[model samples]
Target: MPASPSAKIRANVPIPLSEKAIATRFVSFSGLNDDKEHIAIIYGSPEQQEAPLIRIHSECLTGDVFGSQRCDCGEQLHEAQRIMSAEGGVLLYLRQEGRGIGLYNKLDAYALQDTGVDTYTANEMLGFAHDQRDFTPAIDMLKALGLKRIRLLSNNPHKADDLVKAGIEVTERVQTGVYVNQYNAEYLKAKVDQQDHSITLKQN
Candidate 1:
């Protein structure tokens, strides 16, 4: 984990999500790379808890906002919200679209995927790494929230490894729900096979 610049709370506002019927605290941060507005959707009073549940979710415009079935990002985001809303947690929504390769490049990679290449291979064909997401911003966000330790809600082991390297103690690793659809079955399998994401898929 590389050292990132320290972040501070830029703004905090209470916004009620109509679909989930959950009142969340929308927090934005300052002093990050790219000057993009990453958000921290706070479900409960994590500052009051010993080890709050945390999910460092990367942005997925197609999947998260438009509900694209090509990936499980949207499902995972909602699942995190459902659990955190009840159990008290912080969802750090990092603006790392397309695993940090940017949106247009991601679409180009998608075109390559349509030609029978896996996601990682498509990225490689475009001269990008398999996963370019930098977790330093996530560390900065966590530190800004005054969280020294947390129960990480994710299936990605890299997240835990990065946090630990940055001196943030991950108390527990909780797996998110495995959302397998016909459109994303290959994508999900690639995650488990290539990246070692902790997921169990149905054997057909």
Candidate 2:
């Protein structure tokens, strides 16, 4: 539909993660408009598979690095790694912190959320859109990897839709495990209610 993205691979190095057994390579790209350091974690041999599993994970600083249970990001990331490690897939770790609102804004939103508001409402109150992430760069990264078809690993339908719109055929959509705790229950509910994420969670 649109012009093909002209992104190119900058570097790809095989780096063993802390979980030594999960073999992966960190792939860097150049020529994105935002110029952020977004990377792709390749596990096994995706190019050799007919439809490799792929996850377009936005960067979550607090939840991902710090193991914050306020959200399910950290758990989901590790789950992706486990799946990709065994089944062979790709992980496009986008530099879209806090749904593209940036870290500081997200922290501010967190303050609002602590006051019993939904995640989306907090952003709206701050004069920002519910989800400000741009998946265009992800598409470009996929193109650079020469992936025409994939099996998407995500609960959000938007990820699959965006990939299809950008000429990447999503052959299947695999839902990630729902890691719901007391803290993140409402947060998960907001996502399911607001964005129609495909997650079935019983009330705790």
TM-scores, in order shown?
0.95, 0.95
Candidate-wise lDDT, in order: 0.90, 0.91
Best model per lDDT? 2
Which pairs of residues clash in candidate 2, taking residues 3 or more apart in a chain or in different chains? none
lDDT at residue 116 of model 2 (Cα atoms): 86
**Which residues of candidate 2, in runs, are more than 4 Å off?**
1-4, 18-22
Write the residue-wise lDDT of candidate 2 on 82-149 in tens digits. Answer: 88888889999999999999999999999999998999999999999999998888899899999989
How much lDDT does candidate 2 score? Answer: 0.91
